[model samples]
Target: MSEQPHPPKREIFDVPAMTNTDNKGFLRPVDEYRQLPYGLYMSRPADHPRFHHLESWLLPALGLRANIFHFTPDHRSGQRLYLDVGRFTGPDADGRWYSVDWYLDLVDVPGTELELLDVDELFTAHAAGLLTLDEAVEATEIAVRTLRGAAAAGDIQSWLDAQVGGRMPWLDRPVAR
Candidate 1:
């Protein structure tokens, strides 16, 4: 195969940027993935080896799926985020399948890196204390809100950079696998 080019990175906008107000643009209308706080939207986000009650049962109900998420670069914002989604299939009984989605922001700065995600593997990572469901939800929620706000507000590229704390070079070339 041929060599791949570098994608765009994060950029910045001016102070007090515009708000997209298009919350619906990020996730589905159903809001099935909306955060409920406390424990996992799928499993608990706290420490210890215990998931929060209903949270634990949710995994089995949805079936375990996995995903290695990726996001196309955005020239406007200058960052990369994963929209990884997967599904799980359970036994014949009730006939259920679970879905796990991730929206990890790109990080080359300190204390950050791309994380692996999937149904069982992702959950296992969460179980291993890799990040935690709460962290994931909080971060993703911020990302969705921030980006939408910036887009809607018509924030300049410079403002976008400050919001994400990095240049969005990933938007230049195609994203690597």
Candidate 2:
């Protein structure tokens, strides 16, 4: 396969400052941020056509950032969850979080059924030297592990609850219609 153009995907979560810097470097105000033992939680308004807001949990231990996009009624796609496989880290000295996306994503639809997306993008990015060998391998492993765990537990939420020892904050919020 030929190498395709792939931009670096990284995000900055500055909870103390209540700001989020998107991959494109646009700064957006955060509505809320909560630091949990397992990860950092962020809820922010999105200036997008399809979704007005989003809530995400950056679970570094699982190498997954789980997202709930509060989609507009016209754009509801029946996707329950979106998981990004990536290297996530945080709170170095400035109490900020970071994420480096690995070009692979998992979309949960209807229920626990997950459809992996962007495998070709991953391979193409790897070929283009955008991701190191270790990162590519790690992304693949995380995606596989998440799928297996969710399948075994009967749902993604169950698997995540087991991992974090309880339900996440996003679980309590009703999905915006």
Number of the top-ranking candidate, with TM-score as the measure: 2
What is the C-alpha lDDT profile of model 1 across 1-177, one tens digit per residue?
Answer: 122322111111111221111112321111112111111122112221322111211122212111111222332222233322222222224322233333233221213333333334434445556556774454455445544544554442333344434442222332243
In angstroms, what RMSD does candidate 2 have relative to the true structure?
3.0
TM values, all candidates: 0.23, 0.94
- Listed per candidate, the RMSD to the true structure in angstroms reads 19.8, 3.0
Clashing pairs in 2: none
Give the distance in Å from residue 104's predicted Cα in candidate 2 to where it truly belongs: 0.6
TM-score of 2: 0.94
lDDT of 2 by residue, 16-130 (tens): 8999999999999999898889999899999999999989999999999999998999999998889999989987799999999999999988654888999989888888888
Stretches of candidate 1 off by over 4 Å are: 1-103, 106-128, 155-177
Candidate 2's C-alpha runs over 4 A off are 1-3, 174-177
Report model 1's TM-score to 2 decimal places: 0.23
lDDT values for all models: 0.29, 0.89
Worst 10 residues of 2 by lDDT: 168-177
